[model samples]
Target: MSTIYDVAKEAGCAPSSVSKFITKHGYVSNKLGNKITAAMAKLDYHYNGLARNLSTKTNNRIGVIVPFLDHPYFQGLVNAIILEASKISKEVVILPTAYNANREQQYLQELEHNMVSSLIITSHSLPYTKIYPYQRFGKIVFCENSNHQQTRCVFNNRKEIFEKLFTTLKQKEITNFGFMFIRNPQDSKTTKETFEAFKKIFNHYPQPERIIYNCRTAEDGKNGYLKLKRTIPNLQIVLSESDISAAGAYQARGNSDTLIIGQGNQLVSKLLRFTSIDQHLDETGILALKLATEATSTMKEKVNFDIIWR
Candidate 1:
């Protein structure tokens, strides 16, 4: 309940001197500074972040928007961003939208009101047009591919990575394929690009009969495999969107000759001993943070990834 005025009165200094000492905006004698510090401790005074930020016209905080926090892929990304932000003494505020467009828009509106200095969008349900209008408020950076002119985008080459994955599978003499995707191909850019790559490489084979959708967890992976086995009957390979799902598939399929590939190269992938695409999520987080905080010439930036063969 103690305010700057209380601390000032206790320290026998004017409020302006207290403000200068607290905000570090102007020089205060060391004796006065020590007195103010002592008074604050004695009174248990706490500074108001919002009021301070409003007065300074800046918030040493960054907002990160993600679809889910349970997934290791996203958890890794967020952790990396937080670690990098800490180096600059900045804090992170996570806005988990759960793929809700309205929630994302609400956070965007908050950005315009200066709730955060910048926003790092890892996934979004709102279109670029709706998001573009808020760029005047602060830096808006995308962790996925975007063609927005006002904001910067840092993303991986999903299409190219899929193409490489397809090549590797073909070289292994695997033909009949099944893929597990998190969302509808029509709704997800990565899913569409991955499917296209699969089609290009498996042109000689029949259309993938065991395509599974909405596979977001390890249990989904197991259930997807069971479904694929029953439907396709001849499914020889499985590609999953996440390592957690792949871990589930491995559990269901057991030690078999069926080739399995997973994305995100998560800890589960290593434990399951499956080949996975290491998208370098940590690098993505660090780069996204940098782009969000610093000015860059290009509006879009691409980060490279590799397939980690286990």
Candidate 2:
């Protein structure tokens, strides 16, 4: 492998001059730059980005910390972030933690070590106490709601959206509805907001049997629909966590006249011709990257959302 020293020897220039030319950190004369370029072409040399980043204390890479990769919701968000980063000439590194606290902490430590310029945490198991200390290392942006006032986030305004959704549903005389979740109500603020919104509009909390937990895939949604059917035979509607899950319910409800509402307005929702709430994931991702790269205030930015009834 050709190193910087090899390029320097071939170019007959100081290694520092070669470094300056390659990293563009300091000025190098046009003649020295041309020589280094020729030397690199002859030696087929490739500079180490990690080493350069360490020396310059700068990075063009942004890390996105996600909890799960199998779910389409996260997959869509990642794709949006990657596309947005590419437009700005930035690199994206996806770090999956599977909701593991230790793994999340390790990825956060990467920021502390300057391995990543900034991090966009889609979800995490670590508390703010452990994660906040590393803010001194780099910008830490959240893709979901945050309790702390000091943190920066770009999230869907689920509370406002849910309130409007339930109000609309109630006006349509839709009652006896159930909802699915990837996490328990206590663990996710979104789920809690959903519950509150349902209670406010329906004038009562949904029965425990109507709530489905640990739902991430189409299979989970199919099973949840079947389970709810057994309990509440007259199930009128099921609000799915994602369009992927909603597709399952759409398939399982074969001849039933039940309404299947989904979130995220994913491709499946369009193809399956089901109703869904479009959370504007693309916009959220774009804004999250902007927040990480630019000087943004430490406040929660809510992505606009709308319902698509089919």
lDDT of each: 0.86, 0.88
User: Tens digits of per-residue lDDT for model 2 on 1-310?
Assistant: 9999999999998999998898787999998899999999999999988987876789999999999888877888899999999999999999999889999999999998889999999877788788988888999999887777888899777877888888988889888787888987766766888888877877887788888999889999998888888888689999988888888888889999999999989889999899998888888898899989987664678897888889
TM-score of 2: 0.92
Regions more than 4 Å wrong, model 1? 171-173, 203-209
Query: Which lDDT tens digits does candidate 1 get at residues 196-230?
Result: 77778876433556788889889999999989878
TM for every model, in the order presented, reads 0.92, 0.92
Off by over 4 Å in 2: 1-3, 29-31, 38-45
Evaluate residue 184 in candidate 1 and report its C-alpha lDDT on the 0 to 100 scale: 70
